[model samples]
Target: MTEVTVLGAGIAGLAAALALRDRGVSVEIVEQAERLTEVGAGLQIAPNGTRVLRALGIDPPGPESRAVHLIDGPTGRSLIRMPLGPGFHLVHRADLIEALAARLGDIPLHLGRPVAGVSDGGRRLDFSNGQTRAVRRLIGADGARGASRHFVAPDHAARWTGQVAWRALVPVAGWPAEAQVHVGPGRHLVLYPLRDGRLLNVVAVEERAEWVAEGWSQEDDPQALRDAFANYAGPVREVLSRVERVHLWGLMDHGAVPAWRRGACTLIGDAAHPTLPFLAQGANLALEDAWTLAAAGDPAAWEAARRGRVTRALATAQANARNYHLTGMRRALGHGALRAVGAVAPRAMLRRYDWLYGHDVTV
Candidate 1:
């Protein structure tokens, strides 16, 4: 019998499996998809997440990010540029998944098994295929909608945030190694180069009364994305014009789940806290959870140690969503303040996130 069974083979699951196995614990993975594949675009791994990857013997695979440039979308004016420190990387999701999976040699990975629910105090996993399996322990890394999350923290409903985002990858060359946020009224777009500057990842978010379903696979017309950002100037417009395919999803605020542990089951990543894209700490927090959970030796204790940091990160990300979409006087004041700071004390702005980017969970 495997010592621990992890649900869902995404970043969280795979990372947990590797971390445990490397610590001399027997671990297995059960994934719904028949094949282990990451279906998304680029993600930023801040220093905190990079520390975990380095500890696991996996160097982050991508170009090192030099800075984050916040620009005014309508006028194409640069507002501020915050230089990043070492270990910040812009990596393709698929590439990171592959790296994690490759390190899980000889570990049991049961794919194509869709879990319907959990029973018998989180020990029995009921499958959608009319099969059931009993495991000694469980790690719920399946994601927000996975059975593990529902079992660990039940009765929590995610309310729509009245915002929808379109994600696409456009081919590009010679782009600088920096992440750019184009801020506009009630909307914002983030762009960064990925896969060795071969593809530029575009994530454009807009406030909408029209409700859209929450999930990454939902396809949206490229024209709709273009229309949403029609007023954006400079390279943002040029980039949107080239988007032939895009995925749309409604941003839902799951708010921190009431519990990260129950019985023999525990949650990590989106299964515990589903964050907005504003802070770019989703994957980073997941990486930290994987490492700390494996190293701590007790699930409940691990959750306690992680709760504060995770909660702060979630709140920061939510605040950023609101700040990025300011309008009218607020927009002008915010932009002017940022410009002032950038001109006089640029490094201070980057230093504001020292607690986040400097955290070393591996130590």
Candidate 2:
């Protein structure tokens, strides 16, 4: 029997365990946290990501909404709005986390057991409580700051992308059903409905310097986020005003790394690559990584099969960040052009994202 240990019980970790278990591999999951939970706000899972979930035999049950187009926030005009197809779904972070955790059943999950170190000798994992264990294979789904990254690749550090994001979830009783992104100068705001029209998810991005706190729980002044978009028109001000609680965090990007695996240990999710939210593919990419890693029959082939796809996904995410944070004259001209085209042909604008939403990971 092949025994595998996965670090971190996040979406990627759980998905890896599930995928591996389905393939007849004995799996043990070790999580540093005392319990499984999700922080931050809502996350949008596009078609590519949804296909991975179905492949894992995990179907997320909830209300479904379509993102028709992206719009210029200041002018209240569309950039692009295309049909998202059947696989696109949205859910709260906690909801998705709970769903993944529930699927693990009785699989040994050691919580409050933070990994202190990982050694290459038969994949030794040292826990915070002075305990140590050795396994045949180790998977690092541990996230951006996990000890696995250091053991696998010591040269990599998460780079800040000079931006911070604030997120919140409000009631959807009065919100639009279509997912909308409001783009502005040096900032952008996105809104969509979740949980069968019960909640409206809000995510606002702003360009910044000197603020480098990562993760989703950092406190940020709603007024500060509002001030960044003070010039924007439409429903942005109303949404910002209604926001009583906000979660803020710096956007960090990890440039492509050499390899996600080292010897008997391999990396997954944020542990392998951290991406900006511009493309909303962070979680989707993580899920895809889990599926690919688990589906690979031989551990030796892991790097070869995953490296190219992961690199391309990271690059696409970086390009999205640059496109979303357009500034000065470029921002204005881009908005003007989008508004002009949007007014004449909205469906054509929506069709531009077919490559993104139309992607099917099962292939």
Among the numbered candidates, top lDDT falls to 1
User: On a 0 to 1 TM-score scale, where does candidate 2 land against the true structure?
Assistant: 0.91
- What ranges in model 2 sit over 4 Å off? 340-356
Question: TM-scores for all candidates?
Answer: 0.99, 0.91
lDDT by residue for model 1 (202-282), tens: 999999998899998999999999998888896888999999999999999998899988888989999999899999999
- In model 1, what is the error at residue 334, expressed in angstroms? 1.0
Positional deviation of residue 350's Cα in model 2 after best superposition, in angstroms: 5.7
- What lDDT is obtained when candidate 1 is compared to the true structure? 0.92
**Local accuracy of candidate 2 as per-residue lDDT tens digits, 118-170:** 98643899877898988889999898878888888888877778888888877
- Model 2, poorest ten-residue lDDT window? 60-69
What's the count of clashing pairs in each model shown? 0, 4
Query: CA lDDT, every prediction?
Result: 0.92, 0.78
